[model samples]
Target: MPLVDKLLILAIGAQVFLAIAILVLMGRERVPRVMSGEIPVADIAVERSGYPLKARLLSNSFDNQFQLPVLFFVGALLLLQLGFVSWVDVLLAWLFVALRIAHAAIHVTSNDVPRRFAAYSAGLAVLTLFWLWLLIRILLVPSA
Candidate 1:
């Protein structure tokens, strides 16, 4: 397998870890209820003391992180199939992962909305760059 493929797999693993962390944090007996479903809000509030605001925000950040990896995986596959692997691709992929981890850490620990937002914005920028690079490469490079 190629290095990019390895990186992509690693990205998926990181996402899974983030998801599990979110689950565990919510399991803590202090998280609040914000979802609506068959389970009553009161029941949720009672069952779990409910998460701190920071925990909830961190979970949401992880959710976003979880989604980005899927998109990156698809983009990576497409790029590899097309035979174009650049530093930008690798850097952007890893950048997204790093930013997300940092975002989750800041959010969970300090409820630092501004810092978290900055990290999220950086991740978004990387994703946008990936898409643009893919588009440009596909259009400018001749098909095999």
Candidate 2:
């Protein structure tokens, strides 16, 4: 496997860890109530709190991170088969993974919406670029 593939696997592991943390945090009666059902009266008035805001942010970050790896994995495999893998693809894959980690840290620690949004935008841009790169590369090259 290429280094990019290894990095993607690491991203998967990070995502799984975050997902488990989210599940544990959300299992709490207070958080689960807000997430699943109607807001309890105490929650409405007092604002039920658990796991802090950072955990929630991490949860969202993980969710976003989970989708990109799956897409990138497919793209990588297709590109590999085509014998057209490029440094750009690997760079973009790593960029997306790095941004996701930063996003999660910012979300969980400082709850910085602007920073999170910026990271998310960057990740999305990388994804778009990767898709375009793959499509153009495959289309422009003759089939074997």
RMSD of each: 5.1, 5.6
Instruction: Tell me the tens digit of each residue's lDDT in model 1 across 2-70.
Output: 777667657657756876786687555233345534345664464432454555565565566557667
Give the winner by TM-score: 1
- Model 2 segments more than 4 A misplaced: 1-52
What is the TM-score of each predicted model, taking all chains together?
A: 0.70, 0.62
Q: Please give, for residues 9-115, the per-residue lDDT of candidate 2 as tens digits.
A: 56546655655665565456346555665565454454434334544554555566467656766776677676666667777766766776677667667777898
